[model samples]
Target: MSQTIHINRVGLVALALSLCANAQSPQERSPIGAVLGTSTPVEELSTKASPAVVHIEVSSYRTSADDGDEIKNQTLTKRQGSGSGVIVDPDGYIITAFHVVKGARRIRVELDRRVRANSPAGELLNGKRRSSFEARIIGVSKEADVAVLKIEAQGLPTIAFSESNNLKQGQLVAALGSPEGLRNSLSLGVVSSVEQQIEPDDSLVYVQTDVALAAGSSGGPLVDIQGGMVGINVFSLTQRGREEGLGFAVPSPMVRFVYGQIRHYGFVPRPYFGVDVQGITPTLASALGLPTDSGVIVAGVGPGSLAQNEGLQAGDVLVSLDGMPLQNVPQLTWLLLHKHIGDRTRLEIQRKSSKIVLDASLISEPSDPEGSIATIDIEENLVAKLGIVGSARKHGTAGPSPTASGPGVLVVARLRESDTRAELAAGDVICSVNSVPITSVAQLRATIESFKPGDAIALQLERKGKLMYMAFEMD
Candidate 1:
């Protein structure tokens, strides 16, 4: 689960369009339209972009539908799911929605039929596309609902990202993906809204469209008429049980930002400012008798965090960060993600009728902890139910914190690809089970076996120098 973010540089290819076309006589036009029959923009776009719009196949485990007792006792079953991914690199980097591949034991990508026809191997046997490649996860951002994957190939056809903020309402868009296992399906629509929140409290936004999204269309690309990537298709509000014509996509700007972070760090890292801020409201401003009716008011500051260390505290109004004005939480959240570890950023604060500035370095996660790792070759070290092998924590072996002193069982390897409920990594140290400290492999196994099927289990683990809890139901 530990990863370092990096980037595989990609080139942006913009398809140029004619702003105006000359008038044509009735005789010159075809029945639908000469443009439709001839060099249609969408036709050209599909030609250019479809090669990179790949069909993804995933295999994962899901609980069965059964009675309470039967469900608890039954083993998990495998599920086959299909989605679409857009290749973004010539070296075979593909981007798709995280949900499409979440908890997947295996992932495979099939290139477009046209690409398969020209297979370098010169033949298709077993009815398989020679271009089909197994994909390895580069990284995933669950919050943003995006995942970057890589296939072993060279000189792949790729779709480049476009500026999503430049998109306006009513702009023509095309949806490309495999819907119902039919690869290279295309649908036309218009931009319904540039940005919208699915939930009132959630900061993540989507580009709304009236696209004809059917089942199995998730993770596809919503491209402009010229074929530039505008967003990755997430979900439709529905054709419902009735047609609502509602669909949404994660904007490309956010995708580009997240894609870069995942490539670099294996995940998106929201930089820590240590100060929590709330948006100023007219009512609150009146109640507090504050100067400005709109601004970010600091609610609290984390102790020992860089902000607290830099002299930030509660009740202070955050006027701006690195000179940009801040007014709302979403804006603040979006801005903070741009800061990386070791980067120094300036914060403008309005405190007690005076403005002051403080510079602080971003460090939400610490450096990797150097420690001894256990070997899983021995049978006695296996924690079979958890799908991991373990060993006792030894003297001088620890996480980043010097204060993390205790007996714990260290994970050696993860054996079950299907049992990823805990996402336990090799270097992780299982410290406790339901608050009871674990000191050996047998103890950990015994503790898990003690629980009944469907019983809740919470494990405290130290991973990559940080302590965190992963909870799941015993099965």
Candidate 2:
């Protein structure tokens, strides 16, 4: 089973204050006048920012007939998801994190109250509003983890973009999102740092802030005091795999890049290199007799790839791209995705005893150039976690069972001595794992990884119209 992470929404202010008051007695309470000074009022910002924020929900369906299962039936299931989005146009286009509505079959939008509907109080509140709308996925950038959505609603309020280039460290900032299930939540903090690169895969310039964002805050806007959006909150710092208060956001430049592509072309055209690279450390470079702190070492180039055709070979050190110094692997990857195909780029590198320059034309994904740009390779680690590889059944499903069809993931390759292989036959169709429906390879792995070795695992399989239970040790 694979590991899973989820976000939670924060409660409303009145409820939070009530909870705090309940924790204390009358004597422990502070004077109301003194408490005002301790709090920085954000009501004005909230009133303006809430209109630009929205909630998203999605649903999907799967059919057993598609999986080749004997059941030959169909099942409909709806998945609900919540994330923050910024209205980018008066015509109702929205921008959000890609993971928010990935694989969504249906999407629904909820705008601030009082915009088109009466406030919950119904007192003809002038500033309070709530409106419901429908939305659809317009485009997605898997490499950049951004998605654009559009709505039919007109005259929508939009947020203004500020120059992230001028953002300074230690400046005050606000994070607005639906944290822990509460909508239109706001938190205050200061910019901790700027342009701090933390991950090799995170090449988009970022602004690190000390905002107290909790779960369900991804895709929220990080705004300056003037209420202009400077960045989009994406993720938080995790030490030893645990989340900390320090959060990071995508700077306005990358946001504008993705937004422009989606607005003009309806999709982001990511440049593909068809090659994999490994970082070169100073010590390793010295030992290899190469200039220290210069270039990456090509590990593998895909067959018929742009890099392979351009004479990019393994063990070569990549020093620069388009004459700009390449400090790390992420910088190179960013350059590749930063433009469209037909854009020419240059690579400077060292091969063994000599330096050379390679000029190349960027290309789209070979098979589906306009599809998702995420590189696809068999994840051995992810497969090993499942202990079973499934092939789409000739007339059945290849995924885990109990999915309205029956149990067991179709067996493509079963690891030797695996528990499932011992109790169930190779060709048998598994319907359930201890009564849980098996859906995809991901679902199978996630379930298995949730248990430890020596844990009891059970399966229900169908072989020739007879259902049987096979029990085994997880290890």
Candidate 3:
């Protein structure tokens, strides 16, 4: 009886051990197994996503030296700049930073994880050494700073798309690209906010994030948690020309919009305005018979422009466009962007002591006039490019009064690299050349040619809406 009881006990122990083994076995493991149940980290998504990202290189040539002789030959020199790009389709269509391929003599696209070279990761570290796939420029919009390219290849991996609409503030975001020419570099951050407008023109709609975007990351995709692209890593707030932590992105919806327009129209659908405007102060609004603290004051309208065609004139306070209230420049930009060309909208205008309404159809601004004419209008490009600008008139407007103000000339616009922009402002009429009266571009050109590179000229001009004489030496 004792032997039988001991055997029974051993059998019971063996049964329990077998059950445990069956529960933990690969075949049984409750279907998931311990390893399979683990969550995947975000880096895995970046790894797969990086394969679709590409680096674009462009080369160009420019005149190196020019001789004063009209018929003399000039030497040409090579110039180069870099930006980021991504593969959007399996058909070899690539999207990249427009400024990158702009004016490029040649363009080349490099796949991210092409080959493992001399480095420990067996990957080619130097992008300049690796072979680049040739690409053709498809479309470009500089104001939006986006471009599209096409190459000859297939079976390329494409990133999944995510909507910025669903992206929440402070959600994690990742950036993958060859930032600063370092291949396969990854940086992580969070969505700082949504709908941030950082452009000086206030025309661009952006997704502001805390992602680290360097010079080379300009066109890289901003990835959300699901590895889907939320935005394209773009400009960052800068101080003294150096980057601050605040990074901005072109939202994915805008990216898709840009791509669609480029594919369909071969150019961006930029909105236009024919009316000159300035922010209205409370005092100014009251004087103009408008409600204080509302809308932009219409200073003038361009002849034969969309505004003039719609019967909009000077002294009309623009209160709104369409059904949307126009509180500021950005508000107007947003409203116009919602509609396309040929779309008609009603505008609320306060003229004299009565409110009026008018309908206008949006149209594209005409291309800049060709040829170099002295009286031709040049927009204030110097403020963004040269850090200084000089306009020929007050308010940057043209009229018969400006031509008759003074014959010498005028520095109507200036971007101050010095004390203040007002120190050398627009309305300042240019007079005298070495204490000589001058008029017209021809006289100004002749007087300037007579002096050497480092010569001084006595000048007289207006300042603070009052005429003051001052001298500026020429270089």
TM-scores of the candidates in the order shown = 0.68, 0.62, 0.59
Write down the lDDT of every candidate, Cα atoms only: 0.72, 0.63, 0.60
Q: Give the per-residue lDDT digits (tens) of candidate 3, residues 198-290.
A: 532355667886666777888888887568888887777778976566788778877877888878877676565666666666777678767
What digit string (tens of lDDT, one per residue) describes model 1 on residues 108-130?
98988766423444455587546
Ranking by lDDT: 1, 2, 3
Q: Count of backbone clashes for each model?
A: 6, 39, 12
Please tell me which model should have the higher lDDT, number 1 or number 2. 1
Q: Pick the candidate with the highest TM-score.
A: 1
Q: If both were scored by TM-score, which would come out higher, candidate 2 or candidate 3?
A: 2
Report residue 65 deviation for candidate 3 (angstroms): 19
Q: What C-alpha lDDT does candidate 1 achieve relative to the native structure?
A: 0.72
Stretches of candidate 3 off by over 4 Å are: 1-40, 61-78, 114-131, 199-201, 240-243, 271-273, 276-300, 304-306, 314-317, 327-331, 334-340, 351-353, 368-475
Model 1, residue pairs in steric clash: 4-264, 4-265, 5-264, 5-265, 6-263, 6-264
Better of 1 and 3 by TM-score: 1
Model 2 per-residue lDDT at 4:
17
